[model samples]
Target: MADINEPVDVLIIGGGASGAAVAWSLAETKMRIVCLEQGDWIKNEDFPSTGRDWEARQFGDFAISPNRRKLAADYPINEDDSPIKVANFNGVGGGTILYAGHFPRFHPSDFRVKTLDGVADDWPIDYATLEPFFELNDKMTGVAALEGDPAYPPKPAVMPPLPLGRSGEVIGEAMNKLGWHWWPSDAAINTQEYEGRAPCINLGHCGSGCAQGAKATTDGTYWPEAIRARVEVRHRCRVRRIETNEDDMATGAFYVDPDGVERFQPAEIVIVACNGIGTPRLLLNSASERFPDGLCNSSGMLGKNLMFHPYSQVRGHVDEKLEGYMGPRIGTWSMQFYETDPERDFKRGYCYQFSRGYGPVATAVNGMADGIIPWGAGHHDAFGRMFDHSLGMLAICEDLPEEINRVTIDPDLCDSDGIPAPKITYRLSENSKRMLEHSVARGKEILQAAGARDITSKTIFPAAGWHLMGTARMGTDPKTSVVNEWGRSHDVRNLFIVDGSVFVTSGGVNPTSTIQAIALYVADQIKNRIYELFD
Candidate 1:
């Protein structure tokens, strides 16, 4: 608990990518800033370098509480119809700490729906508006990958592209035979020593924190500058609510410290960057007499438009061992069919992340379950045989906003503090369904073209990758949005939501880059607007 003599200029919740970026952006503004994270800070060294072996803390640091209501998503709500694996990490940097570090920009078609095919909301801003900031974020984050990518936008590569492995190259050449556009996947990693971090060593086990500090997890990038700028980072602190005045202007936030001590920290402005799923739930839980239906849910849309990128996968086992698991978690992407084409019964596109590399523990368990023997002589032989040859390519589908998709407080559930937990209710939209069907077929085609002997495919889960977005969407129309294009809450003057919740539409590309761009844009707006308000 911070003893603030003066109200912090901004109080940010969740120390992940969005929160970290905003905190760094606000640095040196002479404004007091503080970020509260639910999980303790774990460094790159603490992250698992190899298999599940020697990773007790990484696998065991479950945020799941003794109580049922405030449950973190460790257990999948249902067994069947799961997307790959349910993933959730609560710490500074969120999934960015655990992400594959691929950094492909959303295509120009991503921002405009009516102009492209007429479905989703036109981004209040477009690629042109965001391109410069995207470049800035790529450079600041020490991203690896050369530009000249014809499938996407035009920009000088922030850094050189990562070298793809034999598996990736084989797949790339096959996909090219089909006349589809493909490129060396751009990544938020160092390919050749940028800043203080080393280049990626091609060890594919990136989902668990990079031991070499080559990946651009916030801990390796934004956090360093944030510390240099003198920003305060409070870990193991879970915020309960935003305390506001009669005018609905946020004055502070209430939080529980690591030792279960309750405290309040004052703030001139409260920025909620707890990602898409967590952000809305926080708002819905911030119940007060003034806000009976969540803090900024006057339109009754706090947790609406919930989305999970309905993803699918294509597995491959070439005749020759590709040694896929020995490379970085990811190395490249393919967006040949990204634009929405109604002629194909879909209104959006999908991206292919060709690196689905896994380590020994994941491989042994999953392979054995998939019918490779797990015990005795057969098990040992099968495990060793499949270890070096397994490779997979995943299809990341774009989901459109539907009224039925949502996140709400579970009336029956509560956290450690007796507060209700977030109950996510979601189903694939028709557009998402169409997108998935198309992606699955195309992914299978790519696998066969690459001469894969045995291939398998998987879909994206709402919980996996934690790329959830659009629950607290932004738009120009007040009738359908919670915030302005700049991410200022439509109803609350001094309260703003800066996470993935503000997206009117979610793209196939990862949201971290967009979130960073929005944070930078909002920081600028706050600076200019405050000056205008005072003058």
Candidate 2:
């Protein structure tokens, strides 16, 4: 037996990035909207930066991996079968709470991968269709960047770019010497006072929740506005499954409240904004007589085509003290190899996102782990040499859609609520391997140009699974994708998805900006065709 709640006009699951955007966008409709979040609001005072052991907390309570964090709101993901582990935050702001705020939009060529590279499937909608939404999202998020980047098409910055510190200046000069395209990163962290949030004061680690409210997490941006517009967000409610009627249309969802009691929330329309793995897990768990496979899985593509942006890191140590840890984690990026070239070994290409070095504790811990810093007497001297003298770049490689690399329900692993957990079955493609190699070689060249010493490289960074996408892809054909071009389900018309799960192809850059843009675009379509939305 379950307590049935009053039916609302719209019910949104997951109050993260895309969910927050959708709720805010649809608020103008004046329809009853309720958003269910698994986690509660995290106060700014509780952020890691406010504590003495901030760096230590990054590996513990605020760890990106939910398994390690072991928070009550988090559901364990069985990623033992894959090389790359899952990194996410289960909260009102979701992964954005732990992100470095390096926001980048997908290139125009990203939407036409098959046409340009003859590798992955092309997205049903092009970049132009979502350009306005991208601009809107940028304004709302207060993206900070420089103008006149040769890589992108005339996208203005919401604020002046974050100051290019010593590391950024060095890297930019190196790229200039190499004649590679480099630009200021479109960061979500506030560079100046905007939207009532204070500017970033170089608080060092932006990944562990910005205590100064500088970072543009959705909980701080959209959620407040949506709440003011009468959107009700219920925290600490974990959805077990979506419930559908006999006609195979989503009626509501069955969720466990904070009290551990089952409750049914009915809605005229249901929108799933859970991330890639979570969306698939919920859909698979919502199996009914009509949907023997899963809800909206008539195409059998609900849990297929999982893509994780393979990440690589290359670091170099300079003689001059760069003070790398004194600024935002990321500063500039290079799109020199973003587009595929006939001469390259890989079909698609990647982006070089330059990042500053770690804090004091991180540098010490990593140095010991890498055998750079020995125990006892030699420790202080070695740590002194590396503390603020290092700079690095992450090679964010594009991951093609592969049906074999999927998210499946783990038979043995279950969450605290007894709901089955998601298991990742993924492997790096040969193209990804070659792409990583090319990027690493180029990265080393740039570091050498900058007169760096002791350059080290790490390929396939095991814990770099921050970007989860493509499990429930959107496309024109029902046989290939779970959702239609408008993000509506092919099997269930009234059900929609607005998350990384709806991505058709995983681009080389971070997907947060593009994900929010797509959500806003879907919300616009729904608003325009409100009467025919269910048709």
Could you say which candidate leads in lDDT? 2
* RMSD vs true structure, all candidates: 3.3, 0.8
lDDT per residue as tens, model 2, 1-535: 9999999999999999999999999999999999999998999999989989888999999999999999999999999888889999999999899999999999999999999879889999999999999999999999999989899999989999988899999998999899999999999999999999999999988999999999999999999999999999999999999998878788999999999999999999999999999999999999888899988898898888899999988988899989667889999999999999999988888999898888998888888877788889999998888889999899999999888899999999999999999999999999999999998999999999999987878888889999999999999999889999999999998899999999999999999999999999999999999989988
Write down the worst ten-residue block by lDDT for model 2: 321-330
Stretches of candidate 1 off by over 4 Å are 1-6, 50-86, 372-385, 459-465, 533-535
Q: List residue ranges in candidate 2 displaced over 4 A.
A: none
Most TM-score-accurate candidate: 2
Clashes of 1: 18
